[model samples]
Target chain A: MASARSDRRISADHIPVKLVIAGPFGVGKTTIVGALSEIEPLNTEEVLTQAGTLVDDLTGVNEKTTTTTAIDFGRLTLPGVVLYLFGAPGQTRFQVLWDELVRGALGVLVLADTRRIDDSFAVLDLVENAGIRYAVAVNHFPDSPQYPPEALRQALDLDPRTPLLVCDARDPASARASLIALVEHIRELVLS
Target chain B: MTSGRQRRRVVPDYMAAARLSVPEHISVERTTLVSIAADADAGGLDPPASHLLALLRDEPLSVYECAAHLGLPYCVVRLLVAGLVGNGTLLTRDPPPSDLPDIEILELVLSGLRAL
Candidate 1:
């Protein structure tokens, strides 16, 4: 594959490809991107005023005077391809921007925390609704109870084909594995 | 509680100042990448727009990246980028790609990750 792509380097005219890394707050979405990014991830913030708060469901979130929506991004450049990994903001209020963010994304990686399993639902729903193929990565947290693969899969009510695996977001190798799973899933979708 | 948007009735000084130079018709996407157009005259642009031209003189950058580099708010940078794009001082690039990665590239990416 590398030999085949040697001649396909992305030009200034070609659109840059992106893959979204999504999950709820405190789920290590940024950590995963940071681990995988070759350069230090860049975080871009947008101010969310009180009017924006009305639509946000901040149940598990810490209190804040003025909400700052942040999206962290990293880039991976190969011989012929330039892929960007963008971490999606976890808050529901930021849903307004999802369409724009996901507009040209290749696929999405939805990180799930076993402790807050339900927290992944909203993001999963958004990805599914966007008609983007996605894979769920259960971020391995020390305190979270461990479950069998089937149990975790059933809890998330995932499609039998959806890839689900446990990964340590802080570890680059583990994070890359999750991304690989997502890319493979995207390939399957395309081929089918 | 008074809403933050409702309470901040007085326009910010910078915004008021920018209103003098930036026209209203210009609009920009949050993620738009802006680069200086070949015909643009940096000296004729507003201070903010001039700074943008300097930043993009070498290469294009997304409006979000510009905001971070300029230490300005995203909305403020968007306005600046929009103004430049509207006046033909700046040009926008192709949007991000939505298609699947090429089979060869996808395999290569997976292999590269494994090798790393």
Candidate 2:
């Protein structure tokens, strides 16, 4: 039975590419992943061990050694390559986890909610500090105010060369356009 | 969230089995893709390792997917994957280049996205 089962399996090689979607807690990071992903988004938990010194010590000797954080991700298959979209945990406490997530990523897409545009500051800093290329896509809500590209860029204090665009996280075409813009930006940087 | 925090005090039963030591050089992340080695000998592996191999035999998967499917902690699955990699029982595809991908790959990705 085992041999037969093994025979049915086909061995194929594929290169895995990672792209991260980052934003504040309610910035629709997961929604963007769901929109672009071919499969249902999957959730995985990572066990983070906070340093002993960092934890609060109500009992004097801290015993809280570990905490688990959930990361939602989705996959897309393209020819010989597979694209993985990871929704980064939005809390400030997961700085270490952010480092791991972006270690070898192609680029990051920072989603912003116009109503809470300030919430994206911390995430932008994290992405910049990591030295990875990134773009900002303001997720448009019906009630949120709309501004010109240059005005929004100025408000966010983004670098002139950085790609800034607007998208609707719930719309597949809009989400895909944001991703394409990010890739084009990365390509431009590489060529330059 | 409360249950996850509460469960940390007691080691889960799944982790009580013999611990597999991961090598120093092998780094397992949620995005790291793993596949079974071409000439792997599947005999004599522990149940977890065997199960991991069985899963990978069908198609390559990221470490997170493997952990989720096995119902084990991400850390435990990392060690299991690292151990398998150390013994040449599996192969790993590192994540995309840290800086920027090659122009050709980027173009391919752009075309693929456009086509979709």
Candidate 3:
């Protein structure tokens, strides 16, 4: 079976592919990771150095030199590769963390909440400025209002090339489709 | 009624405990994959390095996962991993290329996701 082969491949050598699932707080980033991760999602605390402050300070005194944040991640083993999905905090204050998280990542999926659509702008800007390919997945909550695809695209101010879709983070199939959309978007960019 | 509040301990200086300096290229990202070296000799390794080796011996894990399992901060784990890597006791693989991956890899991932 593919699972047996994948297990053996992982023990041996296989490519490690990383993708970021980033959005504002309470945007279901962790939920999507939990739904798609083969094993339970794990959270780890990361320390972000205040490099900007450290560099800008002429005096030796530099308070608040570091900030720690907990990031959740999940792993999925493909045939000969292990795909790691990192659920990252999308607030402006966590921009330093975003710089580190997106390093060497294949792409990013920005999860958005329709009710709080404005919260996703910072993440979208971060990814765009980083010059990395990304797709936006609007995680539909039971109580949130729904909008047409075109309206969401305009509201989010997504580029024409960017892929936008709605997903239910609780359902595996739905979550998987969101990921597939992101990958397909990446493929398009690579082929273009 | 007894006070339910407990005092918080001061954060430890992880940098002070670091014995080896990490390389410029080695990142502390949670997704960076790490594995044990094929010819790793377990003897005489420090507790933290030995523990990291044992964890990887079972199976390769990301630096973040190592921290989670060992109850250490990500910065401390990166230093420990760097120590192991410096001594050729462990191997590290950075996450996929910074730019878009090759078309073939993207295809493989898409197919895999589709199958799921």
Candidate 4:
């Protein structure tokens, strides 16, 4: 029985899937991950130093200087598989890290805030350019203006094939719905 | 907003060289759980690399976790991990997402989320 159980146990090679929650600053990306993750989210942070300034491209974030950005992570373990949910660090300068971050990831979940929809464009572009399959979920804020799905689709220039979902990062059910939608989309992609 | 002034870009070549100085074989992948090899006395490791091996003597930890615990930059930790992997002083496994989780496990995971 012990040997049989070992055959079915989860290991490094058995099933390792990473799903990235990506968006611009203040889009509740970490909140969503916290809602779904089994334990308290762990964060990886690096101080912004003088040398780091050279490598980081601070386009929209010109006003900020002294800040530490963190990559938040949560895990889900199954019998023979484990899923990791990572909140991508929000900073254009961290672009170099994205390649390493997305390595071995199954797909991406792009979260957008209606208040500032344009912030998501960069995240979408990066994920698309990386050739990773992704789904977009709009994190609805109470103060943000609401638009129809088609209107958002036009603004974001989303291909019809991509899935757009509505989510409330604070709510467990809402966040789970968004993840389930993305998972279905991933399944569809695999089938096709 | 340049105000018609041609400002010089401060190029920190030393910093670049230092951070990007990973050995040729060290690829940038999210590191796996790493432990010190039995041959801890292997020579030629830099101070930081040797220190990293010493820290790992207790238990294996992921590169990111180690960086957080040590308060070091991710790039530096990555370089050390790569160097150790190259010299066989550290052992690592491939990252996750290769296996299938049965529906029961998925449900349990979902339940965990629901509890939160």
For this target, which candidate reaches the highest TM-score against the unseen true structure?
3
Off by over 4 Å in 1: A1-14, A47-68, B1-31, B38-40, B96-116
Tens-place lDDT digits, model 3, residues A25-95: 66777778889988677776564435433433222212324322457778888876789889887766677
In the predicted model 3, the residue pairs found to clash are none
TM match of model 2 to true structure? 0.83
Q: What pairs collide in candidate 2?
A: none
Task: Rate residue B103 of model 2 by lDDT.
Answer: 79
DockQ of 1: 0.25
Error of 3 at A115 (Å): 1.0
Each candidate's lDDT (Cα)?
Answer: 0.70, 0.77, 0.76, 0.66
After best superposition, candidate 3 residue B8: deviation in angstroms? 16
How many steric overlaps are in each model, in order?
0, 0, 0, 9
Candidate 1: true interface contacts recovered: 0.39
Ranked by DockQ from best down, the candidates are: 2, 3, 1, 4
Question: What is the TM-score (0 to 1) of candidate 3?
Answer: 0.83
The candidate that wins on lDDT is 2
Better of 1 and 4 by TM-score: 1
Which candidate has the highest DockQ of all? 2
Per model, how much of the real contact set is kept? Answer: 0.39, 0.61, 0.65, 0.19
Cα displacement (angstroms), candidate 3, residue A174, comes to 0.6
Model 2 C-alpha lDDT per residue in residues A1-192, reported as the tens digit of each score:
896444323234556788999987657787898899876777665634345234422231133343224676888776556788999855567898899888888999999878777778888989888899999999997777888888889888999999998999999999999999999999999999
Per-residue lDDT of model 4, residues A24-55, tens digit only: 76688778888876646666654444565555
